[model samples]
Target: MLYKLNLEHILFLDIETVPQKPNFADLDENTQMMWEQKSQYQRKDEFTPEEFYERAGIWAEFGKIICISVGYFTSKGDSRNFRVTSFYGEELELLKQFKQLLQEHFNQTRHLLCAHNGKEFDFPYIARRMVINGMNLPYKLDLFGKKPWDVPHLDTMELWKFGDYKHFTSLKLLAHVLGIPSPKEDMDGSMVKGVFYEEDDLDRIVSYCELDVVTTAQVFLKLRNEELLSEEEIKKV
Candidate 1:
């Protein structure tokens, strides 16, 4: 089914997020208590709220998107290329920048967002963050009454599922099995919180995020039995 679609119409993307505060203690008393209740089932008795706070980024309520990398395909005659770009810095500012890109360029019925596990994580997380930050919902990100078929969103992980509905596949593992290079050389999700707080190196995170976008696009191409983009073909815009 993916092979039948025009690749140029899809926007490949990936995002990185972290807890708003470095640690649970940095939050106010009420927020701390709220987190405890929210995370009780996930944390159980093995870890306290403070210790479980490290996993806060998984929840949009406790997290903020630090970086969003987006990519789209362009064609010149028979040759096709993919361009990747990123917005990273202050959370709200970066979100605004990304939203601007969407509104100015990729906002159209033919344009669809493609990401790994985007429907479950990336898409909703971005929408929730936008609302939380007092931003308007973009056409593609908004999910009012639009039926499942109407949503202009595509996910590589969901595609890979093939209706299994019982197993999970990591992006790195998919890339490996599909013969695409792994995007885990820099820092995996577990290490992102520490790197963002302790290392103060958003650049590293940005690079990692962009690789994910590129890898995700490659994964989609592979699924459709299409040619993968060469290194020289992927320009950073």
Candidate 2:
């Protein structure tokens, strides 16, 4: 069990992304053509690439990360609290701040980045976006020639799969099944585009992203058969 891996060494995180542009029509000629080719494989005949562009956020090449929320555990006496912080706003500023946080605190080999499906989605997405932004890769996000055992990325969803690559589970579903509190009351990834573009509510999106980071941590504890964090034990930083 991962309980053997000290919780204090792990930084749990989640990110919110939206299409790089407000809409498909806003893409430059080269990007538009690239998107069209990419969407063809994922969308059906009834959906034009423009209509399907709403899903572009899931693809690192076509999306911009609007927020990245991270949480880590700190112990005080017999109590352990999870402190979460977030970076928001424009993509470059958001990436810079997040990178600074990693470089400052979680840069060491012993610190791990844990997310629900981090290795596949969150980790790679952040790495790809950082390169596109002309930034050097942070140690945790870089895997140029890393041996599998050397990587410090912990993926809760991948853990739950128990080597069953055939099945994929959502963090929400895992939380419910594990008897942890649900984090889905307000909105989900599908609604992120509208929240960011139409509503212009980065605050709302940040709140949602924070919930995912906390929930991912909770799920990890559940998998380890450890007590879930009480509400009072969660802090915002």
Candidate 3:
């Protein structure tokens, strides 16, 4: 079934997010209370809400997307090129730009949005943040009433599960097991918050996000029994 799909129609992506505020104290009193309540189970006396705040990005209500990097394929005869690009800076603006890209170019029924753990994390995180920012959901991201099979999204982690709903696989583990190059050589998701809030290095995050996008595309190709992308075949634009 994977072989039947057109690779050109799929937009592979990854995102980086950080807490909405630089510090836990930056949130208003009511919001801070809400955060404590929301993260209670996860915190479980192991850490205070302020101490656990570094992981707030995992929850859309308390986080904002800082980067969204995408990659897609183009082929002509025997030659193929994978072009990568990113949208970053100012959460609302980046979301708008990403929405425009989906609505303008990838709006057709045949087009798809693919990410590593997108169905669980990336996809819903983007949708929730869009709503929080007062932006209408784009067609691809709006899945309110669509049937499961009708959705135009692909998840590498879900694909690897192969109906084992209990299975969970991280992108780094999947890439390593599948022999795709590691995207976490420089930094992993754990370091994103510090990079964004303390170091203010969005460029580094964007690069890491793009690497995940490229690695995701490579993983998809591997799933389809297709050739892995050579470094020369990947272009950043």
* Each candidate structure's count of clashing pairs: 0, 0, 0
Roughly what TM-score does model 3 have, to 2 decimal places? 0.98
Residues 1-237 of candidate 2: C-alpha lDDT, one tens digit per residue: 476888998999999999988899998989889998988978968699999999999999999899999999999799899999999998899899999989999888889999998999999999999999999999989898999999989999999999999879999999989999875458888999999999999999999999999999999998888899999999999
The candidate, 2 or 3, that scores higher on lDDT is: 3
- Flag the better candidate by lDDT, 1 or 2: 2
- Name the candidate that leads on lDDT: 3
In candidate 3, residue 187 scores what lDDT?
85
lDDT against the true structure, each candidate: 0.91, 0.92, 0.94
Worst 10 residues of 3 by lDDT: 179-188
- Provide the lowest-lDDT 10-residue window in model 1: 180-189
Whole-model lDDT, model 3? 0.94
Query: Which pairs of residues collide in candidate 1?
Result: none
Candidate 2 TM-score, C-alpha based: 0.97
Cα lDDT of model 1 by residue, 55-169, tens digit: 9998999999999999999999987889999998888898899888889888989889999999999999999999999999888898899999999999999999999898789
Clashing pairs in 3: none
Residue 21 local lDDT, model 3: 95
Predicted candidate 3 versus true structure: per-residue lDDT over 117-206, tens digit per residue:
899999999999999999999999999899999999999999999999999998888889998877446888999999988998999999
